[model samples]
Target: MTNLYRAGDLRTPDALAKVTPEQAGWTYSGMEVFDLAAAESVTRVLDGIEGVLVPLSATDVTVTVDGDRHRLRGRVGVFDAVSDWIYLPLGSTVEISGASGEVALCSSRAEVRHEVAVVAAEDVPVEVRGSGRATRQVTNIATPSSFEGADKINVCEVITPGGNVSSWPPHRHDGIGDCEPVNEEIYYFRMGQDDSSHGHPNGLGMFRVYTVDGSSDETCPIFDGDVYLIPEGYHGPSIALPEYPMYFLNVLAGPLPERTMAFCDDPAHHRIREEWTDEDQDPRLPMTSAESRVS
Candidate 1:
């Protein structure tokens, strides 16, 4: 029944973190985070799943799908810039190798196969959302509008500056309202300290998830490398601490016939959207971009 997993709690010998739909008690959506050593390699076969290979902290990574090689010019860290990624189709053999640092394999169950393609960091869409303290940077890696190859999986990265909040107004995509799309979501967090691009273990943040009827409610502190699963609920307000910036990678999937990120906001706080019109967005936003990663 626990939804939050701390760093190292899900570690395996080959991966720093790993989660599968079966392990999460859901039908779709899964992810694995691996810390690779120089010249080392890992291989996986996507039997009935489609996935995206995202480099977390290295620019020299290489991904090979069914014999086709893709060199990814990734960033130094999630806070440093947007990363190059690869889309993997169902029933293909994937091999990840080359330089070091962390890489995330985000996946979802799929029935239809899509073509494999490499997406450069510059090609990813960057959007600054909200206003004032509610501001955050959203890097759309594989959202429905941004990418059309996938049948189920959806992935994105969010960066919240120090003392700010992201994922506000608490929304739900569990088909609770008319036309709401249902999806299982996973949040993989990374917290920054001082001037470091690589996240720190001691850095902290907060997150909350609850039902509208008050049947279930949970709020807790979040740390670097932590993972939170949302099977069903209105979730939001990922708060970054005063001195520690926050970053989270989101992977989502579900049984819906069409892939979508549509959601219904919590009515009580929905009015906050109107308030953002008069407020100025924090200047620290657009924290990371493809141009910023260049040395």
Candidate 2:
């Protein structure tokens, strides 16, 4: 019944973390984080799922999908820069091999099969959201607006600089209010030590999630590799401790006839958006970009 999962609680020999819809008691979203050694490879059969392969810390990654191979120019860490990603359609065979570091396989169940597509880091859209302390960088790797190749899967990464917050106003995509889309979402987190260039496992952050009826409320400290599931609720204010930047990969999916990221903000805090108009965006914004990853 808990929404938060610590890194230590979900470790396997080859994976740093793994979650399936069946495991989370949800219907749409799932993900696995692989920690690969040099020359190591991992294979999986996508029975009824579509997925995006994103490198968390591994730059020398090669993904072979249904006999076609694609190499990714991945960044050193999530905070370092945008990463190249590959999309695998449903009902295919996938093999991922790379030098030492981590990679994430973010997936969603799909009824329709789509074509395989490879996205370079430069092609990924980077956006800055919010203002002042709420400002954060969003790496749109496989969102609905960013990529049209997937049938149901939606993926993105967020970088909340040190001493700031992201995912504000506590929004929910549970199809309530005027919100038309309902989605199950997963947050896979990593923390950076002092700045964007230094990602450390020991860095710390915080996260909060709750329901409107006050049924479930959680505010907990987050560390590298922590995972949070948002089946249905208002979630927000992913807080990065002072001097420790926070990064998270978001994987989302739902049963809607079409894919969308529409969400309804909690009415109580909806007025916060107006306040941001008077504040200037943090200068530290746009923490990472494709050009920064260039070797």
RMSD of 2: 1.8
lDDT of 2 by residue, 208-255 (tens): 899867888889999877899998889998999999999999999998
In model 1, the runs with Cα more than 4 Å from the true position are: 177-179, 293-295
* RMSD after CA superposition, every candidate: 1.6, 1.8
lDDT leader: 1
Native RMSD of candidate 1 (Å)? 1.6
lDDT of 1 at 248: 96
Q: Tell me the TM-score of model 1.
A: 0.97
